[model samples]
Target: MYLNSTSPTPESCEAVYPDLASAIRCVREQWCELHGYTEPFCRNGVWWVFPPNGVIPVCIRDVMNSDKGQWVRIGRVSVAILPDGSFAIAPKSTSDRTD
Candidate 1:
């Protein structure tokens, strides 16, 4: 979500959702609108969208959560948007380290 009046990458930031399905829907809708894509599919640990009439799927965002909060990938870093709207750099998982 928008961090404040001056924050850049506002559209690329994360927001809270009530459940996993809602979070996935939010990402799919936003990514499709911004990039003119139609379909969303997940492979590996990343979520991707198909370009209109194109073959390759583009990685748009990753939606995840833990006991801490909701996590999303922003550029090269994964960040947690806590329930209170604070931010934190999420600790890397084993899968992240290999990537």
Candidate 2:
């Protein structure tokens, strides 16, 4: 479910994952399809995509700083869209931490 002027949601939208790992797997698969590259995974509780041309980080920082709720958990994993039109995955619990 894209909130506004953004990219399309990943495939398997209705199929729910039982855990964060499964959710990340689904996100990664979808991201790979969209970007034509291997998807990056969460590192140290944060997922980030560094574009080759120096794009801003596409982490949840954008949405988290927006009008949306300070913390959002999609299914079981925390998510963010990078500036390069990539996706970031984080632990659902980290949404509470100060940005």
Residue ranges of candidate 1 with Cα displaced over 4 Å = 1-16, 61-99
Model 2: which ten-residue window has the lowest total lDDT? Answer: 63-72
TM-score of 2: 0.33
RMSD of 2: 9.6
Can you list the residue pairs that collide in candidate 1? 1-14
Total backbone collisions for each predicted model: 1, 2
Decoy 1 TM-score against native:
0.39
After superposing candidate 2, which stretches have Cα over 4 Å from the reference?
1-12, 50-99
25-85: candidate 1 lDDT, tens digit per residue = 5544654665477677667756666777889776654322322433555455545443223
- What lDDT, from 0 to 1, does candidate 2 have? 0.43
